[model samples]
Target: MNMIDPWGSSIIDYDKLTEQFGIKPFTDVVDDIPHASKLMTRGIIFGQRDYNKITDALNNNKPFATMTGMMPSGKMHIGHKMVVDQLKWYQEKNADIYVSIADMEAYAARGISKEKSRELALNEYITNYIALGLDVTRDNFHLYLQSENDDVKNLAYIIGKKVTFNQMRSIYGFNNSTNIAHIYTPLLQVADILHPQLKKYGGPKPVIVPVGPDQDPHIRLTRDLASKFNEEYGFIEPSATFHRFMTGLTGEKMSSSKPKSAIYLTDSLKDAVKKVKSAKTGGRESLKEQKELGGMPDKCSIYELLVYHLIDDDKKLEEIRSKCLSGEILCGNCKGCASELITDMFEELDQKREEARKIANTLLK
Candidate 1:
């Protein structure tokens, strides 16, 4: 099994993960999803757990909630944009949206102050979310900070009752050095994922959580614990969609703490282009060999940017992939294309981020 740690960095083996986690392939339902998002069409949104509930909600026009959160640790990169993209899709489907700002987790785990957490949550993260086309407008959306929401905190304390320290130790790989807050966080997330199903908010409807595969452990824990909630409070068991992690430009797991590994949405165009040019590629050592043997798009970070972020058109992505596989696209040329796309994207997002910051308060509950 790939070492998947929600708090730690890992380059996962998605195949082994799908099989082990019992996640159904997203392709199985692609034909049914109405105008499937680019990520789902591209298979980046790869796996699912009991997604029929979401499909039922979509098809039958039933009430379902889309729930996920950000921890406000730092500036969000394009990797974080994956979740925002899906959030927008679910929002368009009229699913009620709930976002949690994990100020408590950031403070407890990373020693980030509440002041800094609020800054990052609003200016850095939430503004970027608004910039990403998520309709954060009233009526449908709500945002809460973990440290601020008394109900969420109380729910966390209540849910903590069913989870054992030994269970936490095994699921999170918590050692003797792990603090109580760190142990409590998975339980906190369980509350975050399930709270939308509480009676006050329409009661026991299906909820969909879109997350990176690293967070699967929390989903599994939530699944088990939600049954306890169901028996008492009528909380619905949650369903989740998993996407692959975006490998860093330097060729590893993308991390917020490692600045060079990612291209922040707020980065200047020059810095973003520089990061792209420095990215790892699957090209041969020489132009001669690359032209003869072709490139490996699967291992190339720049190519992944085209597939996962930059190029939304399936036809355009396919053209790039075919050229790379057939030696027509050299690493230099491919990186240039990716850099151009990324630079243009950063310029647009920078403007939107500024605009988003202006009305971002309206988005928050």
Candidate 2:
């Protein structure tokens, strides 16, 4: 049925998601973007919904905003870096940035307390976000806790009247056993997306939410609600671009709850390097077999780390990929390279995190 639960930890078939969900191929309009990010140019960001609106805004120098949220239920992992990278790209493009700390959703879906959510959001997620180069201090940047934003809460309550229990059930697979808070949380997310379009925040501008494909349900719902309230609020439906998930070290979807599946941003450099070395690779059963059959970069978690974060040069990435496919490179060598790159990255992040933490603490105050 191609069902996707945003709260669930499941691996997704990207091709099936695009085919079943009516998400247009990002490649269809990638050329339309000016100075497209590597995520877009590469196949990492594979699908889109009305992304043309965003490119149009970028091209014409019109105002548009990018909104994304972090549900602070667990440690921020390397997989989460993709969103921060997108935010940095938008910031460079001069798009207004809105970051929502989805504390309410965290409490409802994860059984986390609001205080705990705030602590994790500030210390873990927001700190890494700043360290990763998103200028949260910019005037155009707006960061807020969902539980604290009255505008978001009120709008969610009012707009939620148009929705029903049946719709929530159908979208989220909620049954009678599902709690009321969990049922209402998606509405708050809908509000989180559409709130940036409200008159108080500068009315009716195109907004883009970069997300993983699993979050498609929320995007679809938010777009529908935006249309229904267009006359009343001058709401322009938000645009979205979907990126592929990073594979875990064990070849599953990388997740915060699964320690071995992820390299947490807070992980020590020694631990991060160890994890990279232990990661599943595309090498064959033996040296003889690998040399003859070549490696499968497509199946390697190490290759993904390179493509997604470590290696930014398209030519260099391609060279590595070609060598792997040609059996010119082996898994051990790739792991070593990846380890060095990660070491350099973590070293820099470690240095900046103290200042980043101080800055993060000052935010959402």
| Best candidate (score: TM-score) | 2
Can you list the residue pairs that collide in candidate 1? none
Candidate 2 colliding pairs: none
lDDT of 1 at 196: 86
lDDT of 1: 0.86
- lDDT top scorer: 2
lDDT of 2 at 356: 98
How many clashes (backbone N, Cα, C below 3 Å) per candidate? 0, 0
Q: How well is each residue in 213-281 modelled by candidate 1, as lDDT tens digits?
A: 889999999999898877788877899999998989888988888999999888888888899998988
TM-score of each: 0.96, 0.99
lDDT tens digits, residues 1-365, model 2?
A: 55789998788988888889899999999999999999999889999999989999999999999999989988999999999999999999999999999989988998999999999999999999999998988999999999999999999999998998988888999999999999999999999999999889989999999999999999999999999999999999999999999999999999888999999999999999999999999889999888888999999999999999999899999999999998999999999999999999999999999999999999976
Per-residue error (Å), model 1, residue 353: 2.1
